[model samples]
Target chain A: MAYSPAVQELMEALRCLPGVGPKSAQRMTFSLLQHDRSAAGRLARALQTAADSVGECRLCRNLTEADLCPLCASGRRDPGLLCVVENPSDVQALEDATDYGGLYFVLKGRLSPLDGIGPGELGLESLEARLAAGEVGEIILAVSPTVEGEATAQYIAGMAADAGVDIARIAHGVPLGGDLDYVDAGTLSHAFAGRARYR
Target chain B: MAYSPAVQELMEALRCLPGVGPKSAQRMTFSLLQHDRSAAGRLARALQTAADSVGECRLCRNLTEADLCPLCASGRRDPGLLCVVENPSDVQALEDATDYGGLYFVLKGRLSPLDGIGPGELGLESLEARLAAGEVGEIILAVSPTVEGEATAQYIAGMAADAGVDIARIAHGVPLGGDLDYVDAGTLSHAFAGRARYR
Candidate 1:
């Protein structure tokens, strides 16, 4: 409360960040004001530019400043193998960890009708149109294993079937190096039920 | 690496935050772009305004957009008792934790010759002038317990002595409610040495 008007306002504005609370906000405010004003200026310009310019990519609905996202416009990635993810962060996560050279369709959110998030919110109409175009050979569902995600996957699978295209969901099981004893019952059961024959 | 130019630039700029890394930068970028463009814009404006306008307060060298920081400008605080701290964040921390109604002198940093920081960088010259003004009754050292902090406190103590002003340092001991068994030996020794007689 001893902070000046500008310092306090900056702290309040910083709380808009997802994980930044009041303490972190204050720390960030001081760190920027005291140590790195140039960095703060650069961040301000970047935020303004990105917020003003970035919009949904036309082809994949991923966030991009241009009409098409890099993966969608690259032409090097496999267009026939389309990966469906719940958010833009998910696309980044998968891209960082995997070599799946496939284009992505960002759903933005899963189907949660109770909360009024339905297929329309997930951009399923656009997905359906893409599926019906007969260009995609396979649809890969990389959605979370939540109830709404299950329903969304099922709905998308139905769309894929209607379009006479194959669909597959990413495997839900124990992680590669996870200890079985430490694994939760839900994950263990999922891993057990989806167990594969040993090669 | 699939990030577009604007998004990538935003992420890189975000890395300037003290504790944020690549993953957090990406996460923050997506959260801002996807969920809160208005918040992003607000943050951008705040950063720009704060970076451009905020400067060191004249009296105590604390950060403020005005000529003096709130604490320094407020006539209600005890100007006769000045507390010296390392940074603006320390001021906030002390304000949050304690009811010390004294004004503060922000050192910005301690004596670190290797880092090229010295008495001049910490505004010790202004502190000496303030002490020589003969209004202050006590000078409280609230700097850190690090080596440079000790040296800074010693140096300030010398200044207070030269000005014939009484100086005291905040006690360094184990925190209240801290378990003795878990407390580090150095802290325990300091606590033991600084022990007070119970009434």
Candidate 2:
């Protein structure tokens, strides 16, 4: 017998995960069947649990199980410093550096008009509101170094300037076109520490 | 605020998918938030749907949505020719070739004594029964060239020898220490076409 339709369907579904193509999906599906039925079940359950339970933090747009993310709720974090990023993964990269005690503001996307993503789509209104509230003293732009990322940073910097907030952007230690996820934690941390003020 | 707890949990859960490390998982989680609320929901549904519906074929241990996989039920496939493989992925690889017209027997796993996998665990009894019934005239060994895979193929050959069935094994066009999943489809098809008889 060849692969069952159910198994094929499962393999196709597994391919939806990032970096998992058709072949890898098939290998993973069979491996799960051969060795760890429980792990496969857990993975399915986790996908559902995550999709159903997770939502953007009301404040920073970071992933969270609760209504308020830990960074937002925690009094110990430096609430005065706000680190703006393009995606949640960037936040993880920044946290790994352990240099910044500040909370994060995830843009969730960059300003790509061609792809139909604009400031409103990226929740810039919420960012503006957060800056107006005066709860944040320093704003650090920690987005990627891509052209779209640079454009988004410039747009946000202009907004921050109008708002009269102490605005800064992360240092450019990472190469152009590099993903924050691919950079080493040490270099990322150093970049965070040596951030320069945005002009 | 940093990512919310719910988002964090979802990202963590997504990491279980094949090749989805911590960084990619986080990126996917955030990227999904950008526009795929419905796609995410559909993905969650598909994961559970496939897991619950798929099971091993009773005949070959291949993945199936029904009692038997499509290849087993299809009258067009040559039941007289049985191709034995270590995993269901191998079946897909062969199917993609569109050259062979034989039925398949999926061992679902290889023999690894260290891992406590033996012949009985591989369902050799059913294979022997298929051959003894005289329904199968040719048995093609499509197992991999790895140490465990070779051992499993040799064991199958011995079993086929006792049954007095014509036997052939896939040749080693695959690079040593290379995975079949990584090989190109054309190479795999060529390898399949040029398979030699294993004594």
Candidate 3:
């Protein structure tokens, strides 16, 4: 006979995740059903609670349960130095890898005109308002090095310029501890173009 | 600032699944929160419904919402020919790959003395009662080829012998579509030992 209706529905529902395919969804469904029912219940409740409460932070547009995210609310972070990223996860990635104690603005997406993602969709007007407040002195464009990311960065840079704020893009070069032979040509060229003077 | 408590809780709860590490869990958590809250809610509901309703079939020990699994309840399946497997997933695997229209017994786990698993833990007594009821024919041992699985199979074989039931095992050989050059020595030897006659 076929799988139970609930089991089939669970498997189908699990496929909505970013990377989960049919096989993974099936495996996850079976594993959760077989092994920890309590954990499953906790996951269900967690999803419900998070979904019901978590919304875009009013200040930075990052996922948060409150109006302002912790970074946005904290007085410790540098309000004058704002780092703009394509998504909330990028903010987390930068935080983990760097000691930059600055505030952030999450775009939630790159500017992709072909895909209908544009300035208005990314809440750029809100970002402009934040900039016009005159608190942020330097805006760091921390979008990815991809074509779409570069275009999005350029668009944000233009906005920052109009708002009379200085803008800087994060350095593109050989990764820390990377071998020269393995470094890509584009990155090496960028590194050469932006080289700092040796003592 | 740190992640919201509910977000943190959701990420932690997601790590309960097999093979899911911290990075995958974090990615999943963010994706769910950002993209599809309704799908996430459906997943949570499915988990709750499946956990509350799904249980082992009384007859075959396979997962079911009712007393008897579909295989056990169906008149089409051969009741006289029973296939025993280490877990319910194995039953699904066999069903997908083979035309074995027979009933099944799910052990849920193999015999592992180091972990204190034994005959009673596998519900072998109930299986024995089913065997003693004079199942008309053959029993198939479809356990894995691991040491614990072999030991479990042997134990079941002894039980079947005592019950005067004929038994067979799924063959061990180089897998179909496998390159012989990459086939391990143990599997190659099994293939040689089980060589078939040509017409």
Indicate the residue-level lDDT of B116 in model 3: 96
Question: For candidate 1, what is the total of clashing residue pairs?
Answer: 0
User: Over all chains combined, what TM-score does candidate 3 have?
Assistant: 0.94
Q: Is candidate 2 or candidate 3 better by TM-score?
A: 3
Chain A alone, TM-score for each of the models? 0.97, 0.84, 0.93
Q: Please, what are the lDDT tens digits per residue for candidate 2 over residues B54-100?
A: 77777777877688788887889888899998877778788887589
Predicted chain B of candidate 2, TM-score versus the true chain B: 0.83
State each model's TM-score restricted to chain B.
0.97, 0.83, 0.94
Q: DockQ for candidate 1, please give it.
A: 0.81
TM-score of 1: 0.96
Rank by lDDT, highest first: 1, 3, 2
* DockQ of the candidate models in sequence: 0.81, 0.43, 0.65
Query: For each predicted model, how many residue pairs clash, with residues at least 3 apart or on different chains?
Result: 0, 13, 0
Q: Once superposed on the true structure, which residue ranges of model 3 sit more than 4 Å away at CA?
A: none
lDDT of 1 by residue, A1-199 (tens): 6899999999999999878998899889999999899999999999999999999999899999999988898989988999999999898889889999989999999999999998898889999999989899999999999999899999999999999999999999989899999999998999999999999
Candidate 2's C-alpha runs over 4 A off are A145-147, A173-199, B1-3, B145-151, B172-199
CAPRI grade of model 3: medium
